[model samples]
Target chain A: MSVLYSCSHLDSPHSPLPPTYPSSSSSYHQLDKLYFCEECDAVRCDQCVAVEIASYFCPNCLFDVPSANVRADKNRCARSCFSCPTCESSLSIQASDVPTESGQPGPPYSLICSGCRWSSKEVGWSFEKPTGIALQLQKMNHQTEIVQSEFDSLKEHLESYISLSTPAPSAPSSIRSTRDPSRQISHLTQMAQKALHRDVGGMVAYSARSKGRSTGKEGEKEKYGWDELGVYEAKGSWRAGGESVLDGVDILRDLEDSGAGGMAEVGKRWGKSWDNSKMTKDVLPQRIPLQTKLTKRCPHPNCRHLLIQPDTKSIRMKIKMVAANYLPLVEIGRRRRRIPSNDMNEASEQPTTEELERRRRERRRTRGGIPIKEEDESMGLPLKRGETYLFQLALTNPLYDPIQIRLTQPHAAKDVNTWCNVSIPTQHFTINALKDAWAYDEEEEEGNDDFLIGGSEAGFSEEGTTTTGGGSGMGTLGKKSRLSILGGQGTKKGRDRETGVEKRSNTSKVILLVEVLPDNNTGDRVRFDLEVRYTYKSDEMATPTEPGEGSGNGEKRGKKEEYKNFTFWIRIDLGVVE
Target chain B: MGAFDPIATYEKGTYIETDTGNKVSRKATITGATNIILGGKSIIQTGSILRGDLRRSTAGQHVVITMGRYCLIGEGAIVRPPGKMYKGSFTFYPLRISDFVQIGPNSIIEAASIGSGVEIGKNCIIGKFVIIKDLAVILPDTVLPEGTVVPSMSVWSGNPGKLVDTLPETYQEAMEAKCKSYYQRFRAT
Candidate 1:
């Protein structure tokens, strides 16, 4: 697993065919890429978000393109910003030092790629000014004019044939007289039938189709003889000295002479210079394409709330609804293998034998007290089946107010091969509210006396965790009551043997016992899902509108308390079984 | 997937505090220590290499590496001044690192100047003459090109680093707290 943790999208959470279930591919996105929709209370991924282009700017020059000019410019930079045809890097304008008739160095410039040292002079291109190279190339290039005239002539030749096939409003009377008698009678009957029943839509289409056909029997006016139809040649109308069938042969010879490095890649030739047939030398530089800032909205029909609103001037998103901000950050790190209780008893019975010597070596092997392992290495080791390992599960609250979290394993995981049991040592615990980092230093120095007083003033001391859950209520009595509830409950302080790691702060850590049971059909890996439900107090206060107060009693304001709960699931993959 | 990391337990005195209030680890290799000037409360973690011997060719007592206050060079990180050919001979340029600059573990920084409040993530390669402006974050594994100009408040990531995102308005305060907390957490057994 990667450092990034994400929620798996259970597409068919209630599918009956668990054995043949198709897992969703969206289970592996980084937290930064996932968006959260508050309205739908569901995570919206990139696959589901409706992306709309907010602004388009050239990646090289960073100039915003006008919407009207986007189509004309073919969604590329119009301000003479061309990338290298070979390296695809932005090309810079370099001026040449050729002397002019005025006895001064000329102001002639050429497009040059600094990365590959490719210059426009190689292709015999030079310009008086640095700007508008594309416009100048189109004006002076003779090959482009020939291709343009050829396309125009083809369109002109096909104009009459296209118009002739179209349905005509008026048919010539001389051509109608020379038409086939049998076919003319059938056409007349259909037209007469349509006239008799004008409301019939089916007969209208039949008459329209018949009118589109040109009658071959109509040769009365001799507009074109049957022999003349075969002599129509579109290529004969080409501009003088433009139609050269030897152009392909000449290009092939040039390609055979040039080096392989001179030819552009298929990707580079496909963009902008699409009609450039000379593969080796004719590939021209293209304008840098524009990049867009996207505005993503929820795809849900009922709730189309904005998910991502990117700022145009800066890289910051104006409205970034990432799921990481909403969900509690969970990190699992410390790993330690547990030695069986029976093994210790067996070692004690051996006294000075080889078994006792082996125990001494084992203690030396684990001499680091708590073996420090890398996150990747710790997960790499296989866990023995039918063994129980103690771990610490910590939850950090993202809100300003203290939150109560309830974590549980579901009865069944959809299509997993194996499942493990997770036992929480402490069922209910309150996590401290997030505060400014410097404030923590001050709170630590004042000791627990001031802390207890502050907790009571918040009126949240009853079921509170000492650092966070205190508010105005029973004052000092509230702190005493909470102490009594936790007293003798073995809320284990400091370190414990067999427990991997322990530390206390705004992040609440609790001991968890994960037991992998021995199975007849054993699998290499064991995976399970955890359901996390958290209840947090809403910041928005509601006031009761009762009329029991005295007149002008706005000074004695009362606040209503509101709380909300959210549930999400996380899958944990315990790699390999010994 | 859920395993508690044992090494994170705080153990005091991992860093040796000098008379100047700079917390420098004894394990850190500091060559030409006389040429390095570290401002107060700066940290040089274990296995870090600080090369202060590379000086200008024509210089008379040039300070090769100068780090300002609250700077942290993480474990296994390397800080070396950029050098280039000058007047037909090679010369090393001075690396000036401003206050509140935290270079993450295993990062190799040869930049000319690193501005204040710039936090470079782990395994980043800051190329020669790279000018990083204040309040910038170079994400993990970013390999910036030579002469890259990193603008203020921008977040750069990936190889041949591109501007990926911008820092929030409260980034300065957040970064200061994070650096302070990391320094506080480093301790010896």
Candidate 2:
């Protein structure tokens, strides 16, 4: 029988395609390989199989089986077939079992159908059986049961053992006995050592012993002999290698070897050396009055010792020098001399009243000096105006100081009749120079003052002329005004752009007062008021531009200009004399 | 036939409506046995089989019936009884069901929860009583061991079903926020 197979180059194995068969009149074609039915062990192609197949089959049975046969097989009775011993299902014999030809036994098994209760025993066929999975499963189940029982028993035994082994009440006692005794002994020893070191007097003795050991024998010997080494000597002079009583001494000595050598010997012979004629005064021990009497007792009255000894003359000179240099006794002596004594008080009983008054006067003269008049006034300089001065005035002073001026009129004078009032309006400019425009003209050879009002040519007669003085014709006035107007126009045109513009109002004011000095320099001061109006003008002309634009273009022009026509006017008011 | 027997015999191209309103087409051989319940509104595709009693059980409202729910008999999945019994008295039948679960297409859930909010990747096997909790994610071809309990909000994958990580509770919210931010970042254009 021929089985159909379509061989296409479609890469995937899962692609769907129609099976082909071998026929002259149809599209079917034949394939070379044969396929077998698992139930019957019959090999055939796609055209030969008559029964329908359900389980996975060879390609031949897939195409040849009818749909009705497959359905019938699905519904077939399971009891009609013998059952397989291994799987408990009917089977179809695919091949016969081989005979046991060798000494070794062959497999003794039969094929069964996995679907229905069909077995190969109906076809009288058998095959060798290898180890069956069913037998292995039974063995595993038995083993699992045995292991489970053993595990259960083991768990029970462990639980009982744990319960029986719980600790009793003697555990702490046992632990204490096991501890080592040597450790405790060491701890006690350390505590005792610490206690001993903490006793205060014992600690002091220990420290003293340590100090003594550190210092050793050399320090002790030095401490014992220090007093002898400190002593000084006074004795006879000595030649080199000759015995001298003043050996190892710090004392006054002379260069000559006069048998009386040191400071003490020289002092003793001082009287003997003087000539009898020079010492004609009596040789009696001179009674020297006390240079400094003890006035009050020493400040430290509780000190039992007297500050100066009663026999001051008997003190050895060397001892006195040592006492003065090293002891505080000298300071005590000085203090006693400064304070007044309670006994033998001279001030209370000796001096008479006149004598006491005279002594007081002498002390006053020495402490306070005589007074002088001019010196007192010279100390204070009087306040002066215009020259800045610092003034100090009392309320009763004749002239009130400027600082006492009232807030409302700080510059007003205090005395009304004696005060000078000068009306000095702020001067805005100073008058420097003036020039006459027609100075070179021959017809105008007169001085520039001739053009001023009230000059000699003021009333000159002419044909159409009215009086040229105060009551002039308005026509001449108009003509003269035109000349001024023309002059102003020319000036405006000549001025720089910065200067040509008029100034805005509200300029600041600064007062300038001109005082005319009196002829005798003491007469009343005459004052003149000059109102000088100042306007700043620049020499450089401004560049023209659009209305809103700034002076950036003019600044770019490379020219530097100074101040140009600064006009000043002098207006005088004869106001006051000071 | 007994109540445990297969109620409907399925053939290729034949459509059968399950108790859960799902339309299933048989693509391979199958035997229906005892105690099976199929969920509603699901589909069973080609090369898949269902066997065993599912009538007494409960299927969630939106379950998918591509394969079983508890234990997936996998692709090329075979649902058959044990090969042999100890004695002639023993009769065997394997139980297959799609319980409370949402299975992706081509997944074989044999005996597992397939759980609420669970997303199974294509072609996965689930063993018996494996309670995959809510919102669990199973990657493709993952095999779950028997009696394993997957905690809630987790991802389980790999052959032995190791836990990957617990899913974030605000995972959806974060995703939405990221989308909104992305839109806002480019919205100026």
Candidate 3:
């Protein structure tokens, strides 16, 4: 037999070869025959496969693209394998013709390295279209700008024409009248004569008639009586000299004549007889009867007298007369007996001639004597030039009433001169003086004595000049009188040591003692204690100068500084005085 | 002898065996001689070569080696004892295997063990004493160094045979179990 030669390496020659097989076929046939590139790891067939294509580089190397391009393409590189559109790199094609489902041929494609499998499709090659709605919006915006400019120009033209037009002279008057018709009518009448030359009488009469008609609508409705219209027409005809018609005159005349005659007669009698005393006596008797008689005649059986009497019968006339006469006589006798003639004199023991003389002397002494030194010091008494001493008289008395003090100075003068008037209240004295009088002059002595005497120049009397033996008389008054004097004087010198001492040691103590006592003004009535502060300045001090110095030379220049010289307050209880 | 037995004639150094107990020797150089076992109905394509002491290995019955499977083996893809030694220290390196594994014509595998359901790509260099776990994928033209261990279900590529990624767990498991079931079925037969 012929040896079979096989491609199998086990035997070189054989009578019958097993088969002729290729050397590579053994391994290739056993494998799946799929080619896998480890670099790209993409499978490809032999025919369509390409190597090292630049645009086919995979995603891993694409990140190396320059930042500008990265932003332009939204961080994606273009499709260049050798030079990554994103990050440039040398290209290596890992795949050839990858078979399609139809088995059609195609160019080889590449894949990225295993790190990132980004494909060529992810790069900047994709196309997109702008939306239709965005284009329409741009057109609308352009149209709005044109319309706005046209409106602005129209407004400006209207404003310029308004300013340049001439204003009508009568425009204000017309507008004013339009607001109020009544005012317009009156104003038109005034202006028509001056400006329009219109008739005033016709317009005024028309306006008055219109006003009357308008007001008549609001008047109360009146019912017409026959006599009222008749009298009015009759009077009108009479006043017009009887030629005018009087349609109802006869009836009015008869009614007036009848009523007037009766009223006149009654008025005549009343006027003649109605004296106040007589009328009162006639209308009001001594006593009125309790009941009135209802029947015309006396309702007694067999009574001949048919006179009517009061319903209530009277008591006995003799008894009434006796009681009336005796009651009055007894009252007279009692009054006569109660009368004490010189009994009052004897019971009270009329003062003897010597006692009377002594009392009179005491009165005289109190009235004229100089106040004691201690009293003067305690009362803060100061000397009044003509009056000799400080004294208080009753505010209502005819003689020696306390006077109000007044100070006067010019608006330009700093120092004021004071005067006192006995007629006004003492409290108003200073206030009055400050309001009147001009600058005082040393050379003008005409009113000086009158002022010093505490008398109004208009009412000055010689009796106010009575001498009281110097200042000692100011001290001898009673405690109340002393207090009044001190209170007045202390008001002027409240800041001085002597006055303050006298106030603290004496006045306050006296006030306290008086306050503790029962008030007699209203004999224990409810009252409020009122305390008031009063301040005043004393007389200017007279400073002596050197023998050769002139009086005018000592006068100070510039404005004098005003000082609060004294301040004092008084407390008094006011209510019903007890 | 049965008609189903492979009619292979071995030369001086070649060793051959069939599914039905016929044996043949040939002139090819075979190292580390040991027993050859063939399953009941399995077929080995022609032009396939293998060199290793495979006394500890097995082939399932009814296993088919196709024509492309044969060419892959001839291109130095390895199946049984799928690794070899270069400098001879008993350390093994794996060969490249693709979607399907095969024994190439005139190729040697000096490694200690081979994984089941492994796919060895064509034109591979396998080193000595390497352990290849079950269902591993070896890409074409990959060379594994000696003493390397290819883990189970891994897809390996590159010259040094580093792992690319693991095969899907279910796929790997099914393939491995199918190999075992075939082995069991053949043994039962």
Candidate 4:
């Protein structure tokens, strides 16, 4: 029911095209999600884009947290923003209900959750002031202080051991050369005259350095890549397996009464991995995490150009090279299935199907005659086997100048689930250039409106049901004027009744016939990929090529308009067949 | 797609139409008429309640409920301002709902500010002082807690209202078009 373009992840411009297997969900993306790298001339998806944080800000307070304090603040709001421990929503500081001697609200302020009606009073956390609550909480123990002090003591204990283990920079190199005989101390040899340590090298120097350096503690440092630390003096406070298990008996008793409803969910304990509480009541409110705006670049190391650069101060992007600007918008609409006709016009919606059947009959009359199905017009009906369905694929030109589009099935799609032959009646077509509403004359509007009212099947269908992103804010009047131009004279493709393809304004609609084949997997939606190659004016002037290929009219010899071709693959999904 | 949908014709005298094209249903209950301001082209459906009476205790004139253009308050929805005790006294804060915001049926919104192009689905309980930024979507049956800040271009869902996904860049224009089309489709039979 939707169309998604595939990104190959890497682009090698001159190499032969690789067969695209777009069945993988990760490889396909909507046009808006894709970026076009001009240097490489290829589409890039999020998977192939390099992202770097530009700025960090708190979602709740909207404060731009400075980079220096980001680590110290632990990527949370520095001021007074905190979520509720119970519901995880942001908490509000409320004054206590008790009245003062002056008949004003009391000084005791507490955090409250309006959602679950949770209060800090239950946890014995009452602040003298409503503001700067985080600073006030820091003064209290909260178990964090205990953990911090123990970690500090451990670091101090290891300080002396690390310093003694480190070899001094001024130490005699003769001892180091003695430890490793293979290493030549070239610099030490230059300073050898000042201190004649050459005899100090080799066997005797080895014995001097090996006395204390042979300990594996030095090797353990290199093996595990741990930082050098000092002395280890075990304290009475630090005892292994010393905590009592009987203290948790109350928690078990509470669990028996309240069941698992008293327990905290896994998501609530995400950032509190160091000391997470199993009981919901024991969990305390934490600061909300900060969000970041990221700058995106092409993943290619050689071609690391900025694809998206967001402004640090605002939501606006300084530079964006989205693929929507470069590619033609393709949309499939006006779906109709072919039904058995008793009596219909000889010049039907499809002339090619009748011609092909006639040719097949002439070649082999012994075979059963092929039945010509009529256009049913009613859409959303389950497709029948051996029936033909016609679809209108509208390609809106993105460029200001006219472009020629050639849509072809590169090869038979290898999808095993769906069985349907999708064919394009008109392989090649030229779409008009996109223009502003004011640029289009009013006469054209009236002319196209007539087509809409007169065209039998076009008064009110899902004309704007675009498979991709909808049309850019073109006024309703302009869009209606150019939606249908049926029975108009001197059109480029004059045979509208035969090919069933029409053109109005910048959009060109083509007839796509899908013939359903009987299969066991008829429940699956019919899907296929199309390779669209568009030839557009490149606008190169430095070294212009021959001017004959500019606009197909072989005109404008003086003007330098080089044409370039770009090809991209798109996968379309049709609803399930009956 | 909304442009192709059938016109939603309401019976005559059901909705009172203003010169600014705002449609206020006759059956809807609107309190504190002097404190509420409905922007041009907005619609208040039947059974909806706008509590503009929850104004500040101060004597001077103050707009309590200020809704913006093209906003839609669905049936049975409650729009009330958030109030709290500040400086030894209780005072109500003004609720500002901006342009193109659609609050679905039976939802209760006591938020301080609901920004432009926000779509709050049916049966949602938007808590007090919840500031939902532009182009955000709160899914149906969501229970957003008090002071929850829903950022721009994000989708919020679930009881506690955690961000689930983000909207595309084109969502702003798409939402504007949808709101405009829906307003145009709504008419008198």
lDDT tens per residue, model 4, B68-167: 9999999999999998877758999999999999999999999999999999999999988899987899999999987888887789999988778877
For residues A36-99, write the lDDT of model 1, one tens digit per residue.
7766666556777788988887765667787788987778887877766665555777667675
Point out the higher-scoring one by DockQ: 1 or 2. 1
Q: Model 3: runs farther than 4 Å from truth? A: A1-578, B1-17, B20-33, B37-49, B52-101, B104-108, B170-189
Summing lDDT over every window of 10 consecutive residues in candidate 2 chain B, give the lowest-scoring window.
B1-10
Error of 2 at A169 (Å): 38
Over the true interface, candidate 1 deviates by an RMSD, in Å, of 8.5
Chain A of candidate 3: what's the TM-score?
A: 0.13
Model 2 TM: 0.18
lDDT of candidate 3 over A192-281, digit per residue (tens): 433454446555536654664577734311211111211111212223333234524643455466564322233223422321211111
Where in model 4 is the C-alpha error above 4 Å? A13-23, A152-245, A341-388, A394-403, A412-418, A430-498, A502-509, A520-523, A538-560, A576-578, B1-64, B69-80, B83-92, B177-189
- Tell me the deviation in Å of residue A303 in model 4: 3.1
| Model 2 spans with C-alpha error above 4 angstroms | A1-578, B1-14, B18-20, B33-35, B53-100, B104-114, B170-189
iRMS (Å) per candidate: 8.5, 54.8, 68.4, 4.1
How many clashes in candidate 2? 40
For model 2 the local lDDT of residue B3 reads 8
Ranked candidates, highest TM-score first:
4, 1, 2, 3
> How well is each residue in A336-387 modelled by candidate 2, as lDDT tens digits?
0112233313444434435445533543343234321111111112211211
lDDT of 4 by residue, A1-578 (tens): 66777787874422122223334556677876788877666788888899998888887777888888899888888677788887777777887788888887767998888777889888888898878787888787456776676677877766654454344665786456436633334223323422563334544335434542476556523522332332455432433423346647877887888799888888777766656357887788888788877788988888899988877675457977787767887877667765544442232444354554653344234223554444645445666665667777778776787788898875646333345666776788787677664544443444333333223444434333222212222233354433333113214232233344466566677878776665525676666777888877866554332221233433334567666777778877766777
True contacts kept of each: 0.08, 0.00, 0.00, 0.37
* Best TM-score among the predictions, by candidate number: 4
